[model samples]
Target: MSLGAAPAPGVLEERYARLPAHQREKLNRIADTRRRLDAAARGAYEALREAQDDLRRARAALREAEEHTTRRTGGTLSLRQPDGRVMEFPARPWPPPELAQRVQRLEADVARLHAEHAAASAPAGVTTRLYERLLEHLGLRDLA
Candidate 1:
């Protein structure tokens, strides 16, 4: 059996095509910006994950180094961290400088990427709402 005819163009596409060129341009710009923001959010999320993994490795290394230091010193290693958690690192010998720095850097990177991802993803939703409102205002809500 043959289907009678091809379906008509999408109602939304037809309605969108009827919009004035300037209005179409505006919508396209908003769409492009939303795409860019979404891409950035994804990139930032991946970066954050990598940074967190690096931080985890750095922390483990630091712990091992501290344990060794404690063993060598023949004393307990305990220090209160800025977050109020007591980190047991031989009080006598500090963490290897490079390991401590790497951990700090990774922590900062994770925090920054978290903020960036939030910022980038947030505007995508805002643009979507604005696009819907524009469509509604233009009497295209039903088509949308």
Candidate 2:
């Protein structure tokens, strides 16, 4: 739309065009807020990824320590961890209910937040269905 031409019926674009000093300042503030929100969300997601990587490293360390203890001691891997807590590997593999529950909750939270972020980042007039489809691949749904 041209600056001189009238915008859609109740858009207030005409007024926005006229009040350069006031409206321009307001628009600038809005734009700055939007930019900051985007940056903050991006930072949050990056931090989350880093934390996930760290968690993976910790799990890898635990597994490696178990294997090393098993091979070196020629006995079942039962020893005190760095925190002075003894850990015993189960002989038969079994699902840990507590761990499973925590994992499920975290996955759900991540999915919800991801969906919300994607939706928020989308431009005005974008369809919610389209936004949701984008979230589907991330195993997410729109959230508050």
Per lDDT, the best of the predicted structures is: 1
**Candidate 1 lDDT tens digits, 1-144:** 123454356966887889999988987887788788788889888988888898898899888665544233346665555465665544453666777788898999889988988988898889878877876787666533
Error of 1 at 102 (Å): 1.3
lDDT of 1: 0.74
The digit string of per-residue lDDT tens for model 2 on 60-94 reads 65565454342223333464666667666634222
| Candidate 2 residue-wise lDDT at 86 | 65
Where in model 2 is the C-alpha error above 4 Å?
Answer: 1-19, 50-93, 123-144
Among all windows of 10 consecutive residues in model 1, the one with the lowest summed lDDT is 65-74
